[model samples]
Target chain A: ELKVEQNPLFLSMQEGKNYTIYCNYSTTSDRLYWYRQDPGKSLESLFVLLSNGAVKQEGRLMASLDTKARLSTLHITAAVHDLSATYFCAVDPYNAGNMLTFGGGTRLMVKP
Target chain B: SAVISQKPSRDICQRGTSLTIQCQVDSQVTMMFWYRQQPGQSLTLIATANQGSEATYESGFVIDKFPISRPNLTFSTLTVSNMSPEDSSIYLCSVGRTDTQYFGPGTRLTVL
Candidate 1:
């Protein structure tokens, strides 16, 4: 069975602080994706890590994948209140099908 | 990335009722997926709606409970039958193209 686990299901951070969310999958995957969901809003596509050692950055957020280790990370640098939301990491194990298995989201709250 | 529009942005319904959510894509896509996000929980994939065929449901999800239809490559619908409070959630529609999935603004359902 394929399982995805995320650490620190709930996070509270002060403004300008840095934190990282970790995602570990039980099986090898072809690609990994990161998404952000605001309160009562739809999900926003964050990063698509397609290969091992792939790294992507947008604004203060960065995502990386280590396919060999079956792990992915979403790093927040200099967090702001607007960046507070639930982040989810999803894995697409089969390269043929686009079905994504998502991890339990990490809810982050950034305070000023 | 394809722009997906989901109808009935939100709806409040009584118990034992049913609701059908529609998703329309701006471009043709072979794979359209439906997902459900419960309050404070991660997303669970309901099914993969393929054009010209029946939807493929995931484990713990049945075709009867969440019936889906895809008459073409750019449109699909998911109907939740006999809904209860337990069915209250955000129903999201997504399309996969070139190995990346883009989401639509979800339909928020509240079963009273």
Candidate 2:
């Protein structure tokens, strides 16, 4: 079974601070996805990392993948109040087809 | 990215009743997926919906309990049968094209 783990499940950070959320998978995966969900809302696609060194950034967030280590990272640069949301990482194993195994998620509270 | 929408954005249901959530995509997709998210948790893929075929469910989920219908390329539905308090959750559907995936807004089900 493929397992995805994310640390610092609950994060309380102030605006202007930076932090990195880690996503580590137990098995090799073909692709990784990052999503953000606001309270009582649905998930919004953040980034897609497909290659060993794939890195994607949007606004104030950046995500990178290291396939050899079976790890991925989502870094928040100078977070803002609007960045307060729960972040999740999902992985598709080699033969998973269209199925996704999601991480535990990191809930971020960006305070002013 | 595809524009996906889900019906009944939210509902409060009585236990034992069945609720069918609808998912519609703006464009045709080969595979659509159903996912469940408990309060304050990450997503767990429930099944894979494919047009003109039986939906493939994940372990710990059964076809009878969570029946899925994929009658066409741009639409699918997932029915939760005999709901319980434990079944209270947010259900989302997604579609994938090549390597990118898009998600619906989600349906929040509160079973009492």
DockQ of 1: 0.71
- Kindly report which residue stretches of model 1 are placed more than 4 angstroms away from their true locations once superposed: none
How many backbone collisions does model 1 have? 0
lDDT of 1 by residue, A54-110 (tens): 999999999999998999999999999999999999998785547889999999999
Top candidate on lDDT is 1
RMSD of 1: 1.1
Q: How would the docking of model 1 be graded?
A: medium
B20-104, model 1: which lDDT tens digit per residue?
A: 9999999998889999999889998899999988889999999989999999888999999999999999999998877688889
lDDT of 2: 0.92
Error in Å for residue B90 of model 1: 0.7
At residue B98, candidate 2 shows an lDDT of: 64
Q: Give the number of colliding residue pairs in candidate 2.
A: 0
- Interface RMSD (Å), every candidate: 1.3, 1.7
lDDT of model 1 at position A90: 90
Model 2 Cα lDDT, one tens digit per residue, A26-88: 998759999898898888888889889999988999999999999999999999999998999
